[model samples]
Target: MSHSYHVYILASKRNGTLYIGVTNNLAARIFAHRNLRGSAFTKKYRVTRLVHIEPFNDVRDAIAREKALKKWNRG
Candidate 1:
C-alpha cells in the first residue's frame, strides 16, 4: 500500500525553532525526530517533538506543502 502525507514543522516551544518536512508514515517520522535521527536541520537545531502535522492524500500535495513551509521565515 502507498501512503502519503504533508508533514509540517513544529518548534520545541512557541517560536523556539522551526522544522519542515513531509512523510508517508507520521509515527515513524516523529519517532525518528524524537530520537535525533530525523534530519540534519532538526538535529542541528534540536527541533524534536510532534508539535504539528498535516496528512495528505497525494505525494504532490505533500511536496507542495513542504515547499511552501520552506519558504516561510523561521522567525
Candidate 2:
C-alpha cells in the first residue's frame, strides 16, 4: 500500500504563532505537537492547533510545497 504525505500548519491560536511541517501521518504528528514533542520551535511557541493541511501523492511535492510555504512572509 502507498502512504500519504501531508503539509500542515500548526498555530497557537488563530493568527498566532505558526509552525509549518510535513508528515506522513497527520494524526500522530499533531499528537506529538500537542505533547510538546514535535519540534523545539513548535513546543516553545505552543503551536498545537492543526490550522491547515494539504495532502500530496508525491513526497517531493509535499517537500517543495513545505519549502515554499516556509519562505512566505506572514504578512
Candidate 3:
C-alpha cells in the first residue's frame, strides 16, 4: 500500500490569522479544527477555514514544505 500526505493552511477569515499543518487525512483534520479540537493555537485563533492544501506523495516532503511555509514572513 502507498500513503499520501497533505500540507494545508487554515485561516480564521479571509486574509486572517493562518495555521499551517501536515496531515494524512485532510477532511478529518479540518473537521477537528472546525470543532475546536485541532490545536491550541488554531482553536485560540479560530483558524478553522481550509484556505489552502498541497498534496505530496511522501510524508517527508509534506513536512518539509510545511516547515518552509512556517518560516515565511507573514507580511
Candidate 4:
C-alpha cells in the first residue's frame, strides 16, 4: 500500500498567524498541534486551526508545496 503526503496550513484564527507544514500522517500532525506539541512557533502563537490541507502522491511534491506556501506573503 502506498502512503499519502500532505501539505497543511494552520492558523491562530481567520486572517491571523499562519503555519505551513508537510506530513505523512495528517491526523497525528494536527493532533500534535492542537495539544501544543507541534512546534515552538505553533505553541508560541497558539496556531491550532486547520485552515488548509493539500495531498500529494509523492513526499517531494508535498514538501515543495509546503515551501511555496511558506514563501507566500500575507500581503
Best by TM-score: 4
RMSD of each: 2.5, 1.7, 1.8, 1.5
Which clashing pairs does model 2 show? none
lDDT of 1 by residue, 1-75 (tens): 445675777566666877888888887888898888988878888888567777888989889988988887755
Q: What would the TM-score be for candidate 3 when compared with the true structure? A: 0.91
For each candidate, the alpha-carbon lDDT, in order, equals: 0.79, 0.92, 0.93, 0.93
Candidate 3: regions farther than 4 A off: 1-3
The clash count for each model shown is 0, 0, 0, 0
Residue-by-residue lDDT tens digits, candidate 3, 17-71: 9999999998899999999999999989999989899999999999999999999
Per-residue lDDT of candidate 4, residues 5-74 (tens digit): 8899999998999999999999999999999999999999999999898889999988888898888988
The lowest-lDDT stretch of 10 consecutive residues in candidate 4 is 1-10
Residue 11 in candidate 3, Cα distance off native in Å: 0.5
Global CA lDDT computed for model 4 = 0.93
Residue range 4-66, candidate 2, lDDT tens digits:
999999999988998899999999999999999999999899999988999898999999999
Using TM-score as the measure, what is the rank order of every candidate, best first? Answer: 4, 3, 2, 1
Q: Give lDDT: candidate 1, residue 28.
A: 87
